[model samples]
Target: MATKKKPSSDQGSSSSALDSSRWEVSCFWERRLQKELMSLMKEPPPGVTVDAEGAGQNLTQWIIQMDGAQGTLYEGEQFQLQFKFSPKYPFDSPEVTFIGPNIPVHPHVYSNGHICLSILTEDWSPALSVQSVCLSIVSMLSSCKEKKRPPDNSFYVKTCNKNPKKTKWWYHDDSV
Candidate 1:
């Protein structure tokens, strides 16, 4: 006796099911970010340490930490970084911000804990990874010749109505 095989209903469904087997149900970007995180953990940036924990009530969001490198005002200090991964992912960078009470009060960072980095904005490229962002922050801190916060940090953070997204950053000066 010969057995009959079940016929697939739709091409899209069949293709999607096959794809789902390889990819996860979670947002594609989150998976990509997680993979990047794992790679970074294997070889983390210099002077900075990081970890990711599931956010309360939201598994998609991760809580990260950035320990101040040894030679900056942020040195020896511990800061919490929040990373909210959107469905767009590698095409769109994560929404990251420095949180926690001990957050740095730097020229480029706001009191509310937002960071002003070019790579996080217009300079962002799909070629960039989470590790690169952390490394950039590390380099930014190391290059700070003045240990004081930007004279306008408070003003900019408080008064600037422009969204971090709307304001394109110009990273011309490495001097912080």
Candidate 2:
């Protein structure tokens, strides 16, 4: 059997190792997020507005406000979405959710703010940007006919992961 080495007490080896494993800022993603932010600021998408909620501080999180399309069930209503990016963003999808006093009662939106949009999950591609995600959400909301929650909303809300990104969503229904 191989011998197990004791962690060195002087170096606080175990704690140091754990610290190193913790998430840290990535220059690559930071630059990308910054560029995206600038583009959004310059020319925001229709029906959507984006801003860094952690202004002058963190850059990994963003707040998006969306207006329902004119001819949709949610028309004239407004909703807010929060997006949290990880160091591996672009390669990994952001944690997106509706953070609202008025979360939309839509077939794909949960009462607890979790959204079941495929692009935010399985359909995500690195080529997708913050602007595209916002537009996709707008399109999702625009395409809805009736204002209602998901069929399994209550059950899923009660037993779902707090981080929407953790759930393995099944994209079976396209007629949202």
On lDDT, the leading prediction is 2
Cα-based lDDT at residue 39, candidate 1: 65
- Per-residue lDDT of model 1, residues 1-176, tens digit only: 12232334432223345355434223455345555655665677765455543442353566667777786766787777776666677777767678788767666777777778877877778888777877887777666655566556766677665446555555666554
Off by over 4 Å in 2: 1-26, 52-56
**lDDT for position 154 in model 1:** 67
TM-score list, all predictions: 0.72, 0.81
Which ten residues in a row are the worst by lDDT in model 1?
A: 5-14
lDDT measured at residue 79 in model 1 versus the true structure, 0 to 100: 77
1-176, model 2: which lDDT tens digit per residue? 12343334332223344345332322556556766776787798988887544521567788888888888888889999898999888789998999978899888899999999888988889899989988888888888878898999889999998999889898888875
